[model samples]
Target: MALCEAEKTFVLHGVEENFRIDGREREDYRPMELETDIVSHAFGSARLRLANTDVLVAVKIEVDTPFPERPFEGKLEFFVDCSANATPDFEGRGGEGVAIEISNTLSAAYSSPNVFDLKKLCILKGKKCWKVYVDILLLECGGNLFDAVSLAVKAALWNTQVPLVKQIDIDGNNVEIKVSEELYDCRKLDVEKAPILVTVCKIGEHCIVDPNVAEEQCSVGSVVVAVSEDKFSTILQTGTGSLHMSTLVDCLQLGIKVAQRLDAALWDTLTLECYTCSTTEDESDTTCLDNPSGVVGGVTDCDKKYCIIVRVDYKDPRGKLASILRSCVDKPTYTNDVIEDETHRVYYRSCRTAKCNGGSGRSDSTSDDNGSLGDKSTIYCPGIGDGAVAVTVSFSILLFAYAFVRYVR
Candidate 1:
């Protein structure tokens, strides 16, 4: 449902209070998960899941004749595909409109020679040049698709492996090139200058970053700024409403500031050891599997520890699973029953068994005597059975004896 004027005003007030609809502050970004080199066939590939939005980018290189006008320059093309998985609305050519718009904007952003060093890809001037095809697949579009796509593209380019050129031979009307076959002999793209797009959505008197679909609908206008090294690579105004010149300028300044920081973080991640491609194919295939936590190697001692610190914000329901796992570590044996309250709140009542064998550290199992209920829901360990009940009864007797002694004293 679209937000009304009053609802939009409330959201604006929330932003003004430094709290967003999703409880994030103005400068805070949603949780993002990034994975690179997942596609085996592509020269470079990355998948980024920002909240609910999912974007996958793959880079493919093909040798082709350069344009006559710009013989020494290679080519970079952008293609965006809106997958059916994103939404039912985008099932059959439904997403083409947005796809074309995004692809066009990206092409324009990278068209400048300064943005990307296309000349370095030239093999033999006008005769032969490398054409890079950047294919973006939109798996989902909860919101902030543009920013997610841009980030994924930059990361994929950073992960790209370009074959080392050995020699180029030109015959009459034909040319041949030799690429080094050594596994370690490969070149990585210099993505230090890659652009990152930031979307500024203006809702009422406030501007927000990484707006969800509902927030986007509430926004009257938005500006997409692609910044590379504090420079404006592309500035695109989106949405139906108009913006004041003063507001637009302010948005541009904020966009540049955010992009610079984002770029720095991206570079830091890319330079880490985990981002580097493995020299051996077998090792490369196992890279992601080996590092389940996605900790990139070669990080400084301080940075390594920081990377391992998993922060769970209790306010987010998604964090409940982690909280539950942490609570179960010290208990030797535990049981839980799901109960629903009158207010419809559902939670678990967990019970832990007392120590058995007089603290001798022996493993014991437990049994339930609740007939059908016990049979359906109770969990018992091997060789425990009635032993746990006996142990509990003995412990109770000891506690009563201690209480009697204290009373007599």
Candidate 2:
């Protein structure tokens, strides 16, 4: 929607005052909701809702011959489909332009080996490699599409589980490849150096990190910076507006700072998401929304950085609240953010990658108010049966019974 002269003035004044229509500061971003593993058929999948803009990402893997020149690296391709329901402009081919732009941007951002090590995907040099197809569906486009797309792509890749190649047999010019059939016996992509894209909008004498639809309409130009760790991987300028060299420098600085914080938060959320969900083959297990290191038989996405420990001292009378606890909750993850009790102590402890939920890292506190992964016996784990399946199913049920409950009244 085009902003009227008066509306543009209003938005301009807000930027000048450092307060946006949504009460956000210049560098502030809209609150975002991210969920992973939404696509079961795909190797990895994630759905992210940044305010009104919603994006769904799914990863599909296929075995194919590598490029002759770059035999050591596999392939990564991105496809974006902008749903017609997102906006009036997207009703037809109008959205294709936007889709292609985003697709190309992502392509460039991940083009470098230093940014994403595609070599890890190679199964056999010059013969076979895994091709990862990241399919993105844009359900809504509230604004700031580039930033939202980058985040969802990173998360989906993090959740992806690449099938392990067991062996290969070659006869003459024909090549035969064998892949591991066991589920979860797969290699996960290391996204520690994945690039994150941040869009900085230039308004009247000011720049903003996340520009809403109206704010975006009023902007003269925008610069998108893809930050990889502390380095700038790729930068693009959009819109007809031009930036002075000094202005461009400022934008890059802002993009890096925000991207760093964004990377941290993205890692935290990914770790937190994997922590709460379990991976047991049983489809009937109670879905754990937040347990980072799931108990036995549980499915866990072992993309670890910092593990979160939740200590719940059962203060209620024996079996009194079990029935009630099983009935009144709805949302992802059983977190203190949902249930607040003085006895609950939640601590984030740093841990190694791919370790299960029970592995303890360094302790954050020692007293009653603290907990660590090392004190497993001290932590909470409801026993099911001795078998891995039994243990996984039983633990999932007791762990997240509250997360599935909804207040009917």
> All candidates' lDDT scores?
0.63, 0.69
Candidate 1 lDDT over residue span 22-46, tens digit each: 8876655677777777888999898
Runs in model 1 deviating more than 4 A are: 4-7, 273-409
| Candidate 2 Cα outliers beyond 4 Å, as residue runs | 273-409
Q: Root-mean-square deviation of each candidate, in angstroms?
A: 21.3, 14.2
Per-residue lDDT over 1-409 for candidate 2, one digit per residue giving the tens place of the 0 to 100 score: 8778999999999999988888888877788887777677999888878888889899999998999999999999999999898888998799999999999999999999899999999988888888999999999989999999999899899889888888889997778888899774677899878999999999999988879899999999899999998999899999988989999998999898888777766765565222333322233443342233343434443243333333332334421221111111112133223243554322223322223334221143311322232111110111122111211112235234433332221
What does the lDDT read for residue 385 in candidate 1? 21
lDDT of 1: 0.63
The best candidate by TM-score is 2
Q: Pick the candidate with the highest lDDT.
A: 2
Model 1: residue 331 alpha-carbon error in angstroms? 42
